[model samples]
Structures are given as C-alpha cells and as structure tokens.
Target: MIERLQLLVAERERVLGHFLESEQREIALACHSIARAFSRGGTLVAYGVDSAETDAAHVAVEFMHPVIVGKRALPALAPPNDVRGVLRSGDIAVSIAHGAEPAPVRAFREQARHRGALTIALTGGDRVDSDHAFAVPSEDPQVVQEVQETLYHVFWELVHVFFEHPGLLDDACITCGDVAIQARVVAVRNGNAVIEKDGLREEVAVELVAPVDVGDMLLCHAGVALERVE
Candidate 1:
C-alpha cells in the first residue's frame, strides 16, 4: 500500500514537471489568445461542473477581486446557477472536463459561439470528441484532475503576462500567413492527395503543425500554429 502511494506521488511529480516544462509555450499561446479577446473588448467568463467548478470560480475571483491594487481587473464571470447573460465578443468561456463531450460543456460552447465569444476547453482525453476541446492529454484520472488545476492557474498567470505586454498586441497587428484560410485536404487521386480550401468538405487541407487525428479542431489563423484544439 505504501509503495503504491509512493508511486502515485512520483507520477504526480512527473506530470507536474512536464506541465512546467511546457509552461512558457502554454503561457505564450494563452496570452496571445487572451490579448486577442481583450483587444476586441471582451470579458472572460469561466464555467465548469463537478470537480472542475473550483477552477471556474478561481478565474472569476482573480479578475473580480484582485489582491493587489492599481492592477488591471478584467471582467471575469464564473459559473452561475444559470447561464443566461449574453457576454460581449471579448468574453470567453473556459471549461475543464475529462471526457470533453458533455451536455453542460456543449451548452456553454454553443452559447459562446452564438455570442461570438471565445471557448477555451481544457480537456483530458485521448481524442477530443467535442467541436473545440484543448486536449491536455492525460491517461490517469487523478492526473487529469490535477492537470486541470495546473492549467487553470497557468492560464491565469498568462493573463497577467498579457497585461504587462499590452502594447505588443494593441500596436502592431501583423498579417499572419493566409495558409489556414486557404488550406484544404482532398482525397488522393491516382498517387497524390489534393488539398483545397474552397469549402469542399473532404478536399480541405488542414495545415496543422501537430499531428491531427480523426477528431480535432484547428485554432488556425492564416495557417499559424497558435494552438491546437479538438
């Protein structure tokens, strides 16, 4: 029993270490997206059910009640008993789910899409079955749960980073490559697979930097590797 417990502890340490290793990249991606939303004057709304509710609440509290004064307090709303408020375009709905395909999550996702808000789903699944789920990739249930917490805190930290570099996003709006907008993946004809981006279903090439499987969502902007979604 003691040995098993020790092994679990060791595993957790490894998982946390891995998350830390990728911290910089994750921070960059998170800050970039948050900046994009903020640029358009959007608020952040976090929502989660079950155990993940704590994460949602944390996001809300941090923004609503900052510990330090004179700091930028973003308009962050948390999961409510009822989600009826139609937030602005700069608003975001972040969810943490193990399966990544649940009714509550889907409801929030649909609402965000309808309201023209961003949907950031932190998921722990081998494959993402939802329309847009950011796969954190965890096999162990405990690790999945713990990693969700890790990612939530990390994302909050990145939000602070974005605030520091406010000028970078607001000032220069560079033209990201247009590859994603014009990408397509088509069926192989004879010996080659053709890629098209003209809205053809099967012949649309997805310029994904990471290997994409049967189910995944590409958060593509001009074919740049901003972030991977499923």
Candidate 2:
C-alpha cells in the first residue's frame, strides 16, 4: 500500500509539472484576461459537466470570497442550468469537463463567444473550442480534475496582480503616487512588455525603456515602465 501511494504521488507530480511547463504562458494570459473582465465590472459565470460541477462551485466561491487576507472579493457564480441567458458582453464564461465534452458545455462556450464574452474551457480531452482552452494531458479523469482544480485556484490567486496596478486597467484611471512595482519581463512585443511578479502577470508599455528584453527587471508605474532595474 505504501509503495502504491508513492507511485500515485509521483505520477501526479509528473502530470502537474508537465502541464505547468507547457501551459505556463497560456495560464498567465488567461489570468490577464480574467482580471481585465473583472476590472470592467464583468462577472464570471462557470459551469461544469459530470464530476466538474463541484469544480465550478469551488471556483465561484474562491473568487467571490477570497481566502487571502486583504484580497478583495470578485464577482463569480456557478449557475445550475444553461448560462446562455445569463452571460453578457465582457463577462467571462468557464466550462469545466473532466473527461468528455458534453453538448451543453459546448453550447455554453459557443454562446459565450458569440456574445463577446471571454471563454475558458478546462477539460481532459483535446479539441475544445474556446478562447482559452486548457486540456490536461492525461487520460485519467481523477488526475485531470485535480490539475484543473489547481489551475482555477491559481487564477483566483494571481488575478489580483492586475488589481495591484490599477493604472494598468482601462477602467481604472487613477494616479498611484510614488508607487512603483518591480516586475520581470517575460515577453516583449512592439512597445509593450509582459511582466510577471509573484505569479501575477501584466503587460506594460516599455517604450520609455526601449530595447528591454525578456528576463530584465523594470520598475513600473501607471501602466508604463519607469526604468530598467539593474
């Protein structure tokens, strides 16, 4: 029994590690989009099929009532039936499926897309159609669900990163006096750079600090790079 437990633990680690490595960038992007939606006063509507129903409720609670001290609550919900009538533009739709893709989940995501809402699909099978689909690279339903649980938790925790930089949000146009956060550059595109700090990611204008590359640290304020930190 002890040996079997160890094997199971090792397998879980392998599956989780591989997923993080492959989906790290995508996860960050999804978090960024989620934060944007929340900042714009949009709600998160989640639904799950089969065993994932519990996951939908868990994610909703985590976002609506944050566990971390000082973290503000965000709008999230898990509706019992079809959310097509509930979703609106700028809202977020999350569809969770453990192993098989059901018709309702598919229609939920499709309607979300058509309504201009951000769609995220978490499933164990490939070929999901959504703006951000994370398919766990595992055949076992239990392992896939576990990994997806971790994924949504990560979303709940890191979505607050964008909140820290209010100036980075389009809906927030406030002056942050003498406040500059340090972040490491992860990706550079045109005049903007994607930065990460403590698992929170944001893209700020780096035109002022031209020629900055990935792995460089910079001090940012009001959605713009102040200077490169040596």
**Estimated TM-score for each candidate:** 0.66, 0.73
Question: Alpha-carbon error at 155 in model 2, in Å?
Answer: 0.4
lDDT leader: 2
Q: For residues 1-230, what per-residue lDDT tens digits would candidate 1 score against the true structure?
A: 99999999989888777766754554455556675576677877877777667767876787677677776777778856555365565477676665455678667766665665656777666433322245655677668778777766666677777678776566331214443333332222222222323322222223444344433434445324344443
C-alpha positional error of residue 21 in candidate 2 after TM-score superposition, expressed in Å:
0.9
What is the C-alpha lDDT profile of model 2 across 1-230, one tens digit per residue? 99999999999999999999999988987888898889888999999876888899999999999888899898998998777899998899999998777889889888887777788899886947565789998899999999999999999877898789777556432214377988888655445776776655566887889888878999898888889999
- For all candidates in order, the CA lDDT equals 0.58, 0.83
